[model samples]
Target: MSNNSNTLLGVLAGTAVGATLGILFAPDKGINTRRKLVDEAVATKESLADSALDLRNTVAATVATNKETLDTKIENLVSDASYKADDVINQLEGKLKELKAKNKKLQKS
Candidate 1:
């Protein structure tokens, strides 16, 4: 989750707690207070849902970016290894030619 998500959740939690406490202490009629509590609960639920969506988006974006970077790195490593293998094959071929030439010269002498 992102920093903004964390902050938003923290703020929402604080607001919900504060509102509940204030309503409990107030000297309002019981029916009105109950209605206000229901309204506050609905609003808090919506806010939490929105925050969860934001968090999910952030995680998905992060995973996509990391996967791309890892793929690029793996491709580069394979390319480098292929070049090195070709160089080794070339060196071995050169050595084999030298040995064959030396053998022919010795046979003629």
Candidate 2:
């Protein structure tokens, strides 16, 4: 994702630079050259804005996906812990019953 964004930004920058250089080198009246520059600037600004929006959306989606995955893992871990707790409780109860039986036998004797 980082690589893709970098590539996209690089492409946009290259395009803007190429357009500006081309316009500057072209033979034309002063007024025409200035007008071309303004046009190029506006186009570049719009392109950059659009690229930024796209990058923002991509980042937001990735964050949402990661959050969901983290939530699922947490839930699964809690569920597993609950089951283990139940097993431990059952084992303790069994041990307590055995001790009680031994106590009763000693009292009877």
Candidate 3:
């Protein structure tokens, strides 16, 4: 799990523990205390669900952004390579033409 997940779990766990301790020590009726604990548990569950959703969204966004960046970088690299290859082909063609011309001149002489 990520740090955000761990931190959320810790916070939720701490809230439950603290609430339970408070309920146990308070001079409230048993039924009231139980109801309060149940309510607190439900709220904590909802909070955790919300946090999990938020974290998932954040991770998905980060992955999408990274993928876009990688794609652009790959496109640029391929374009650069294609240009370099074309340049090399042009130079080789020029050198071949020069060699052919020299060969023809030597044959005539």
What C-alpha lDDT values do all the predictions have? 0.94, 0.95, 0.92
How much is the lDDT of residue 86 in candidate 1?
100
Q: Tens digit of lDDT per residue, candidate 1, span 1-109?
A: 5578778988999999999999989999999999999999999999899889878888899999999999999999999999999999999999999999999999999
**Candidate 3 C-alpha RMSD relative to the actual structure:** 2.0
The top-ranked prediction according to lDDT is 2
Tens-digit lDDT track of model 3 for 1-109: 4876888889889988998899889999999999998998899889888988888899999999999999999999999999999999999999999999999999999
Alpha carbon lDDT at 51, candidate 2: 86
lDDT of 2 by residue, 1-109 (tens): 9999899889989998998899899999989999998999999899989989999999999999999999999999999999999999999999999999999999999
- The residue pairs that clash in candidate 3, if any, are none
Estimate TM-scores for all models.
0.86, 0.93, 0.85
For model 3 the TM-score comes to 0.85
Model 1 residue 57 CA deviation (Å) reads 0.3
Candidate 1 — number of clashing residue pairs?
0
Model 2 clash count equals 0
